[model samples]
Target: MTDAIKANIEKILQDSHVGPMATVQNDKPHSRYMTFFQENLKLYTATSKETHKTEEVEKNPFTHILLGYEGDGFGDEYVEYEGKVTISNSDELKKQLWIEDMKHYFDGPEDPNFIVLEIEPIQIRLMNKKGKAPKVLEL
Candidate 1:
């Protein structure tokens, strides 16, 4: 990735933390808005172990995520992220991904039902920027 592309991607990751994450189930796409925490290019999102997503990911570990589009139509930038998923319930990660808002869904970081989905990127693209075409980040 070029410096500009990398910078834009970092901006997006910093600016956009909430977006739809898609997983495959029964050969169909299942998507839901999730809050993500990223490190380098890896992304992680907390979810319930009992959720359909956890099961779907177990069957098919692939996922696609869309982040950084805040609905401003005119040349707004966004990211198209395609990756592999790993369901994690490690206390370390649960604690790391814990946030106050998640209390609505989880009791706490140690909540037995709480789990995280760790995404390992397979492909990523910076999309819909002013005049440039979609740019794929080499990884």
Candidate 2:
């Protein structure tokens, strides 16, 4: 990614904590709010192993995520990610990324029902203001 694009991405990630993850299920679009953390140029989020989101992704790995920071006067600043989601139970990744609030979702790295949703972006589009469409930036 270019410095400009990378900066834009980091800005969006830092400004927004929640995003809607869009995935296709049975040929239809499904979306849900998800809290995410970005690391090593990949996106990570935790989910219960028994959720429908987990089952849906297992059938189809493709997904789109949009996160933003809204301003009262200025247009909403946001970034959209087009990526593939990989679900796994890697202890090292969990430990490395764990934050305090994650304890509510998982007992620990060893939580049986906890799993990480890793998103690898193929492309990213960012729009920081109005009168402009999202500009595609490489991942």
Candidate 3:
């Protein structure tokens, strides 16, 4: 990817917004809203081990995530991520990504059931109204 394109992608990733995450379950697609956190190109989300989403990821590591579109009706800019997810139970990482608001779902950063889904993007497409074609970003 060009430097300008890379910068744009990073901006979208850092916008502090939630996005739709799609995972496969029983050979069908299941999607839900999920809060996103990123480190460079890698994305992370918090979830409970008991949740069906976790189980789905465990069974099928491949996932699709849509980010950056916020329904403004003006901009069509967004990103589609194809990635492999790793379920993590590292205390240090959980603590680092933890926030006060997460207590609503997770007991705490150290909650045994609390886990992090780390998405390693294998392919990313940057899409927008400005471009006639979607730009594929190199992972």
Each model's backbone clash number: 0, 0, 0
RMSD of each: 1.1, 2.0, 1.3
Report the number of the highest-lDDT candidate: 1
> Which 10 residues in a row give candidate 2 its minimum summed lDDT?
68-77
> Which candidate, 2 or 3, has the higher lDDT?
3
Ranking by lDDT: 1, 3, 2
Estimate the TM-score of every prediction.
0.95, 0.87, 0.94
Best by TM-score: 1
Tens-place lDDT per residue, model 1, 1-139, is 4877878887898889999999887899999999999999899999888889999999999999999998888799999999999988799988887889999998899899998899999988999988679998888
| lDDT by residue (tens digit), candidate 2, 57-111 | 9999989998875655556778888899999799887787677787877788778
Estimate the lDDT of model 1.
Answer: 0.90
TM-score for predicted model 1 compared with the true structure: 0.95
Error in Å for residue 3 of model 2: 2.0
> In candidate 2, residue 114 scores what lDDT?
81
